[model samples]
Target: MLEPQPTRSEAAARPELTREMLEMVFDHVENGIYLVDGQGVTLAVNRTYEEMSGFTNVQLVGRRLDEMVGPDNLFSGSASLLVLQRKGPVTATYSTSTGRKLLVKGRPIFGDWGEIRYVINTIWDLTVVQYSQKIDADTARSQMLSEEDIITCSEKMMSVVDLALRVAQTDSTLLLSGESGVGKSLLAKLVHRSSERRAKPLMQINCGAIPESLIESELFGYEPGAFTGADRRGKPGLFEMAQGGTVFLDEISELPLHLQSKLLGVIQDRSFMKIGGREPMTVDVRIIAATNRELMDLVRQGRFREDLFYRLNVVPIKLPPLRERRDDIPLLVRYFADKFNRRHRCYKQLSDELVQRLQSLPWQGNIRELENLVERLIVTTAEEIITPADAQLEPQEPELDPDATLGEMMARQERTIILSAWKKHRTTRRIAAALGISQASAARKLKRALESDIGAENQS
Candidate 1:
């Protein structure tokens, strides 16, 4: 028997759900779902529809999708919907009104006549998962963007960050070794947060920041009668406070040699005495130590305990400095811009020239320095746009010979210029005032350089 005739196009059209009809359908969807007609009106939406998005039925019903996205939406402003106009489907991860993440997928839907009638779109909330991922990514990105993703891009830094993640997954002790501000502390914190001990308290202390006299009590705590001004009740040390968690020891190289013996004992035996207590107390905790200074160097200098250094250097994770990964600068700068923008309540656009300047500058201070400079720019710059002028880079005059090394010639030129100024001013203090350096340091460096030159001449 012949199949029933195909339904006619007009009735098959089902009047093609107006953007309004689609909106009503979208409103009921637990997930963010919406339909935009060819003319781009909200055909229908469910109750959840209006709740998640800030728009009301009145504001959204008859409006164009582009207009609905409005001024602040970079998507509309950037002509993202126009991409749908040409491409048939557009998908992206975007931040919404709640500052939450959503996966937006835009697809062209057709009528019975095979005419493209509406763009059915769906948004899936990735707020929690994306946020968790972003935290890890943000940490990895904390290094620098160009350099940010590069941690994984390189086999070496990748191994370091990877080992950090692995060590974070366990309650094992982690040691981060690198140059000053090379992100050792960052890797330690990343390990803490990424590990099984994440929910537990994570305490950080700078061994170098405390005075040598007080270091003992600070690490092990004190009983009421233990010290001259001790409280009636004993206070817990960082290890106890970080019970079931992690304690980060920064600048471990600065830990006194004698104190290193005490610390090594704790690592080996997991036991410590509260200053006045006769009994030894033990608590389970993961330790993550960081040091920009080489413990081996301190060991060679006879200033650090070799045994303690060996104990702390277990699972050593080395972070590369910013100069080694200059490509990460742009990534780091933008991250800083976004960060400082939120902190300072200002949005500053990093201009092309400004980015170029950032690329060129000698970031001897590394990631921390770049972040500080970006925060400073956010605080001080007047225009929303950050330019080369916004960076305030100091201009250095070019020296005479092209063949001369910049390191040597710049110093020579600077000295010649400073000497001329000193002769004109007739005082070291006046010369210091002109050059913006402390008079004592200026005199010292100059004297040393002159003496070194004279010694070289004597050898010649």
Candidate 2:
């Protein structure tokens, strides 16, 4: 008896063509191609496909797609199942036993009667692409880490760095704004270091950390015996000492309204007078100011001088928060872990689970918090692998009294709820949605929560 007539697809495989012609046509193609029956039983594979799969024709043909996949198989899952599920095209990525990544596209061809006839698959090796991306990322991370110790995989942070470097070319006053602990200070230093004034002194003065009355003396040096407890020799101010260099005024928003006017004059005239000296000592100094608080809000509230804000904000860089750049967390974690390990003379690394857990945290304190946690874990934990359970990580916050007033109770509860929601949803927009409030309100609440004396619980 004559053999059953082959379907159109099956006939096209041969189509009165010689085996040599088919082999030449299939083998000459660069991409891998394989064909299977409707039941996903491998019918044939080209030389490229065999080489890609690391399987010979005898090993693949007549075996079902499911049967071909095993623990030791080149590819893990079956794209055939996807095609079978929808009876249509399916595209997926799979890893080979040799560690190469393959992008496979499977398409089904229907017979004359509309029945499934053949499933043709095309595979492209993505190992080159994967390796290229890994290399580029590594190179960028290395350069950034070396220059500024900033470990970031997110494009947002990279863009910020790019902008900062460009702004560093000249003596333009740069204003960096972001959430607290978001590396504003570090970026300020980066700007200073990248600028042409790197040879000169780079002075950092925290406006908020210093006493209100002494801010003036700290900024502009006083004459000998200018006031009570004055230095007899009289020291030069940061602006005077930072001549031809950068003066980073961190927490600039905390500057008093009166001092803001003095700072504005210095920025405009490039000179500032000593507190008790009659002569105005002229000095060329580059100013790079940073504040976690919104200067606009402060200006509107009359807490920050609008003119000074405009002067300092000549070039603004908004450093992205840790939540917005969660992609960098792993890199940061590994860096900090290695850092503290070496510093503490202990070798400790975060387990995969612990890393994932840390990545999921709100990180309101941003990079500083992460660094502290890594160091704390390294110094505290004895084990080499720090797991989630082993770390027993809890965010530090100010505690409330059991018999506190209603206002205190409400503040404590509000902080808790806001932080919890913020943790679950990393974005202010999402947090607003979750809490049924405007994005601005959500941001204000988060800021207030973070500032609340919650860490005071430790003191009690």
Candidate 3:
């Protein structure tokens, strides 16, 4: 049985919809339409909603919406009310009485005084848009570009993956900053793969890898005689080549400040001309920038532009260092070993002691370093099982900059401790009680921790 719900009269008086309009709305709607008061009480239900629930308006008018969408099944914090507060549209998910899932998009209806009148929401049953999920599945494939992916048991790495996937849908400028070898490029590739632009080619450029003189020309093309050794026929630049696709700017921190303004201009105006071309051309290139450097600090020190930083930092996804995701060492090792084994025509295995040694050692170089170690173990270690002794590669954890803030360091330490605990116990309840938190809260925090941990690696 469901809990008894309060009605609209519990707070304010209810308003009426004209009969003709109400009939038109109820009759023409395919998705179930409903209105709810700020207090969560149901006010009106369209014909579609009535048919789905097998209940008349008289039976449901005064019931709480939560009766149908339990707190657990909801996306939480009513988006309708949020829209009402923000005076904007909001989207959310809800479960229906018929056990079908719904994607509810809503806007807050306001009175003349700008007060929240009621939340008018339409729920398009997920089944109707089921076919569109294939686009989402394809987006997922784009991100798996570096199939040498690791076990993201840590919270940070998981957060990065989820954020990358979620933000990939939107055409937002993204900045991915983390420690080196933390799979920054891999995550960037994933974002490209997960976006609607997956059909478009994903072009990658490393600002640090390219010569300083050629970086600008490479990004913004050159005319036939623009350069001393320009192409015979003017070639399209990366921005042009990546039209309708994504251009991942790796090592973005290395981009010269002189070029930052041009990059920002291109991103903002979505148009640029070749080095000597007079007319500007437009291209739709989603940018995912990655850098292991602290860009904010760089900006403060006058090395990076604040405007460029803001443009790219719309979503800052950080990848966790290997030391933080140590629990995944064996998993990654096995994945890489198997990959190298098939490639090298060798059957190499790791020993239990080697795994323990791996866990004990702090992997400063992160997943990339671990991968190299695995390959080395497979290639050179002659024993049937590769022991830690055969894996001579070791990384000394880098020291953090002295100017790193106390708050930042403490937050990082807290994350490390929490992630290590969750990994060790493998249960949120146990970790929560041990850390003196409510079980429910523990679960949420653990989820976020796992999200953030799996995405970013610590620099030190």
Candidate 4:
């Protein structure tokens, strides 16, 4: 099916015309095109690129890409410059003077002598495609993280887990804020386990558990003869020791103000000096800090540094308390019971009625308290089928709020109904339809319910 070739005279006459036609086609192509020589000098660019970048071919053609990167430069940086530096293909995000976000892929072509001849940069508007792709990817990743023994059925908690997994994909500092036993430590481990640095050590230190005097020496290693009773060989700090992994600083709110300042510097610079060492030691470590107390409150009270709090709060992940995620209670109970049963080599089961009762009771201490209660029951009860009375522990009765009026109680009940429906359906329209109310009313009630819960927690 080969086509007839053009005569030599015909081809010769149209060579220049064909080249011009091809160039015209390139200018009209949808994807942005940028071509640069080996020395990073822009050689040719299509109209699509000129339009996308707001940089005309006349201004770009003769200039070096590196010259266009700086405080007063047209570009933040050039992908072609990266291609030149790496001597290979590279992918980057670039921003133009017009504030358009470009996702660029730069490929370098080498000459026969192994020297780069030219670089071709292909670009597209990132907001047009990548933004939606990122959301889809994040949703898929969140589902995977949820499947990893997290044992949560609540959409709210699933969202939290998804966020944690997304942050885990980066080396950015993470701050986990929640009440005690809300599984901050567990989430911290999950982040570490799911991170690029998972192969390395996941060093954990309890800021609250460590003594103040020794904490500095322990965190920032001390040199020999720097302090009395020091070992002859200096010890590396936790940051230094975890060179390529994560350092989970549990109860970070308990970190002294002075130490918090030092932690901030380490986080910002990726370097820290030992307690007694003269030179600053650089470390390639990720910091994952967890706190049972509210760090913002500590900052407001002057017990924590505001600068340090901001540094650690780059990716703040707030964990929902067990009471808020009551849907997970039954799954957790079954998981713990099975775990204890295997450990003790005993066969036991929880009755449906007892499980329901446990789900209804407020788990004030959260997962840790629930686990302990389960283990205690598993070890003490001899019966194969355990009852609520046989467990020998009563649920902590809620204190009566005598200040509340009957109308207020009714409002609280109504709020609960809306919240439960919203949590299950996750859409205002669906929730409203299920509850036989207008979507706007459902949304307003749901917002108030959430705000009320937060207010109650803050008050507590």
Candidate 5:
């Protein structure tokens, strides 16, 4: 049986709802509510706002937003003022003197003559909800794994994160060296969020992805008519846009030698000349560079500048491959499963046997490959429980016996290497070049590996 719903007339006819009851209902709402007049004069605030901002009713009521917002004032900014200025709804994030970060959305009510009447501001505490937390190794790591999305329980990754967080406070250049899809970009973001410049923009550019002809202008701004079809009135580059924040240079090793020299100059002097501009522009930004290749090797090959390598290597942090940190695979699998379930609005679970099987494989593509596999399983699995057969993983090599002799282990490893290189390069000569060995030795070893495989198949 359904309950009868009250009509608008019936609800208005109820005189039992008094002003005191209305105030109670206002205070009981989960989100903080703030009200102000058309002129930005504070009218009233609920109790939730008081607790969230550390401001009392007496302090806020009858005051102007301009009076409460300043360096030494109660709040750093007011969304109500922005609503008044724009005569529309405004959503913004600001800090309070009490060390709380808040996200507020202010909507304006209109008068009979189309004038602004009241501004209703709803607030949510961002500090407690999103970013701010105590920095203990165990607790913080767990919280970050769930909320911050860093997801790691391995000691090696934990130590890497700790070092990155510690150096994030300073302006030292960071060199994040790791394999592709190992979360170098995510770590860079974590560093930025934990730094003093969190409020500023984090500008990122991939050196390899951008074209050689436009890479220079993309790093340093160009004047109007500097090049064909350039933006009129000039434009700001990544360095200019990332002022007072951080610039993440992804695939820094792919940066051309000439541009590398300019980048080194920027790190050395904090300034660069714009395209077709006579004056050099000064910038204040922290640089966090990432590379999948060895910069030192590029330097030796004269493809990357040695000076730039040294400048960006002030705080070098190497992230281990996924195969090395197998402990995090299960956690990552569960996280991705839940994420895709919510996204696709479906209920799915991976079988325990499937998880164990996944953990055994070499994740050559790292966390990214695992995440993609989990999403695919969640979306494509016909049943609630996804089994190993649903994964359709490629056939893997047999695991070596634990009691095998050192010589046997070496021979097996050599065979595996030769076989893997043969699959990719196909020819012994190409395999030798890829593996940095002679062509004759590659052919001999490849033949030996095939013979061993045939003998093992016969025995089986």
Candidate 6:
């Protein structure tokens, strides 16, 4: 026999059930959800948020995010506030006072009149994971072109990636300006993969790497007998070869001034003439240019064409250097270590001391330098655990007093180690983990070390 079902009248009588269901769903969601009004006042926070942040709705529901974020408050920063300021979506990563690092993506909801009504912030924990688990080398290499390979936890780099992904759908020319080894080429590949012309080819040419004499022929293929060494049969240039695709012009600022005008013509008319050819050949291709030097500076110096600069600068994306995004160093270290370990068919893990030491370096060569260092360490280190001593980095030691007692010398050494760790890993929990101590002990020792340093500085 079929069980009796509730009638419309019976269901309507218990309207509270609908509200209860919504509340249950909100609380049970996996990711933390934070809702804020346009005025920046916290509207609601789900149970997930409370669990993740260790703050209840009663404390956050009526509070302003700005008031809650500070050195002495619940958060160090708020992405929802950034969205309200920019009137757009924002993705940011920040550490909480609770020692939890979080990645928050805040999206604004616009009202009928185009004003922002609310901002919804979705949060994800970015805490570093243990490196004991091994990754498959083949699987890691296979994701090189995919989004997963671009490992970054820094907010600045996140914003850059966000902008790149957003602009990938359009056909506008892009100018990627950044220091070398900042992953400009990788980003260009990402843009191509994410574009409408993903099925089409992505032709790459380094303007600086090629000899100036043959650059014209390489970019715009010569007609038969156009030049002494020209092929008998005319060939298609990059613009033609990359038909319905993208042409990544690496180190574009190095292109000779004479070629800039021709490049501009291709940008303006979507056509270019082959060497020794009278008629222009039409082509459909997107242009993505990268440069390490400042194009504007070169323009003022008359080295680069202003018109061409403006053409390629339609959508400029400047990637921050690795040094500027230091928060990503540990993550990058782990990634490269895993990558090389898989490649070499050996399992190796980086010691906390070495990782902390790496974080303190200037990294003038940026990500390229870090990757090379990690690979070198992985292959060269004899043991399964790679340490700072294995890397042969200069030891950071405190100056000793000739007449000081053994206990005093030991105290000085301890202070030096604790201070150095504090410089690289700011949080007490991280410092404690790096130094193999309890969080409470780390905090107490750090405070005493700081006070002693201050006293010494005063005396000096």
lDDT of 6 by residue, 256-338 (tens): 99999999999999998999999889999999999988899899989999999999999999999998988778777866776
Residue-wise lDDT of candidate 1 within 368-399, one digit each (tens)? Answer: 78878888888988999988876777575564
**Candidate 5 structure quality by residue, lDDT tens digits, 241-286:** 7778788899998788889989999999999999989999999999
Worst 10 residues of 5 by lDDT: 138-147
Q: Weakest 10 consecutive residues, lDDT, candidate 2?
A: 137-146
Which pairs clash in model 4?
A: none
Ranking by lDDT: 6, 5, 4, 2, 3, 1
User: What TM-score would every model get versus the actual structure?
Assistant: 0.58, 0.57, 0.55, 0.55, 0.59, 0.58
Candidates ranked, most accurate by TM-score first: 5, 1, 6, 2, 3, 4
How many Å off is the CA of 278 in candidate 6?
Answer: 2.0
Runs off by more than 4 Å, candidate 1? 1-158, 398-460
Clash pairs detected, candidate 6:
none
lDDT of 3 at 149: 30
Clashes of 5: 0
List per-prediction Cα lDDT, in the order shown: 0.65, 0.76, 0.70, 0.76, 0.80, 0.81
> Per-residue lDDT tens digits of candidate 2, residues 1-460?
9989999898888757789888898887988998888888988888887777787899888988876654565446566655665566655456667765565667789999976788888776543211111212211211111122444546688678668867887889999999879988777766666567765666778887788887787788788878777778676676776677777888898899899999999999988789988888898889988887778987897888888989998998999989998877876787677657756778788998899989899897899999998998899887888988767865545566778987987777898899888787777876886679999999999888766646666568
Top candidate on TM-score is: 5
Each prediction's RMSD to truth: 13.4, 16.6, 18.3, 21.8, 18.9, 18.7
lDDT of 3 by residue, 1-460 (tens): 9977757686355555789877897767887787887666778878886665456889768876555432343222344544444455554444444444444556677788977778887765432111221222212322213322323434456556667778988999888887778888867766765577876767677888788887887788777887677776666677776778788898898899989999988989998878988888888999989998778878998999999999888888877778876755765665567668867888788888887788777775678788887888788888989876677634536458698887877767777778887875568865775678887987887777777776765532
Is 2 or 5 the stronger prediction by TM-score? Answer: 5
